[model samples]
Target: MHAHRKTRPPANLGPWQRLLLLWLLGPLLWLQARHVRRITPRMPEPPGQRAGSAGQGSLIRLLVAGDSGAAGVGAPTQEQALCGQLVRRLSRHHRVEWCVLAVNGLDSPGLHQLLLDTPEAAFDVVVLSMGANDATALCAPLQWACWQSRLADLIALRFAPALLMHSAVPPMHACLALPQPLRWFMGRWAQQMNLSLAALLIEKVGRSMHWHPSTTTTAGMAADGFHPSAAGYALWAEGLSQHILAAQIASRHHPDLKPCSAAAIAH
Candidate 1:
């Protein structure tokens, strides 16, 4: 017996409705991307220290990635750079094999692409210091966000450190001695970029992410008058060291860890 069935309403919406949906969803998708990016670390955490007997120690490997500041462009030697100082500090508590995968003049986008081109390997901890160059370029927020998203994807897929720390853009205004327009624009752009980065990171990673304030500057004009000198890197490293130590403290206190061996930790 064939019965007559009632036709249902059209499942598809009108053009206006579709357009409205797209308009509303565009911003939402951007925000969602930022959130997704935050949860994933761009690089692997320093390797977890394997526990030995009660009084034995553990070893860790750290991967540092970023731009000139991260690369310590003005530092005379590797030991004087940001990465070197960081390893020196962390070595006080754990056996550290620190490797820096950094470059000079890289913006957020460049760093993201570099990670894409790298081999997939895990590290114990990852420190990312990017966006300074991007600030100088005066990139739009959306563009920066796009690079950040790519970075997040790389971290999610390959290297996710047990802990990830992102440093804040340092004050370019310390170069305020320059003429009005250049100084004004550079300082304003940097401030905006920092603000955007901080907000996005906090929203996504919550407390899992740490922020290092790069307050050091060459108000007196270092050699280049652009990059920070050894003293400037020193101040930057000092601030970063404090945060890394805090993260390490939690790892050390974890029940799975054995007593830290002084010799191993100091290495």
Candidate 2:
């Protein structure tokens, strides 16, 4: 019998066009980025328990990982953060053991290192909230895709979750905090990065992972205008919880179907 091969999605024209656009407008974008940074407030991560249990039934170990959003910077406490909301939704029918591995400013590379540094653990489900920092930093979509793949591989090797859920980068083009061309640049980059991520997931079709694109608009966010509000977290969490439950109900054994199958269609 011959083994099958999975080819990488091409280094298509989308990323190159974005790169060209960035290069042409680099100077203007840089100034805007600097100004935004100078004026933007640096909010601390919300205080809350990093680990806990919720509801009752068979065990569903959960891990939420990523940067500021994952750390729930906009919310008042950990209970109102993404992890808390996710647990609150998922716990209704199953006992959930959850822990949060997130920080305030970590990007994809930072997240990869964080996971590398943590001790081995097992999880049935893992939620990842990332890419805002990467988007803000203006990382290229192709590079972003590669880093995401590495991080996904790291997560698989370290935690071995039955399901890996990747939270969307959010719609930065509509963020209230940013101004002008900077916002425009970030928005374009963010969309490209998301497309790259969605493509990456498609490449890993055999894996039990899915991308959870933002369901709500960025207009309903927190003080930062980027990180989700408490209510926003609940909304996002509810959406994610539904997807997880649907996947589980379809096959309790493991998440089936090509990764991001729905996300590809939705995007």
Give the number of the best model, judged by lDDT: 2
> How does residue 222 of candidate 2 score in lDDT?
78
| Stretches of model 1 off by over 4 angstroms after superposition | 1-57, 176-178, 206-221, 249-267
Worst 10 residues of 1 by lDDT: 1-10
Overall lDDT per candidate, in order of appearance: 0.56, 0.73
Candidate 1, 31-107: lDDT as tens digits: 54355346532321222222122211465656667887677666666576677777767677777756676777788
Predictions: Cα RMSD each: 17.8, 10.2
- lDDT score of model 2? 0.73
- Residue 64's lDDT within candidate 2 is 87
* Per-model tally of clashing residue pairs: 13, 0
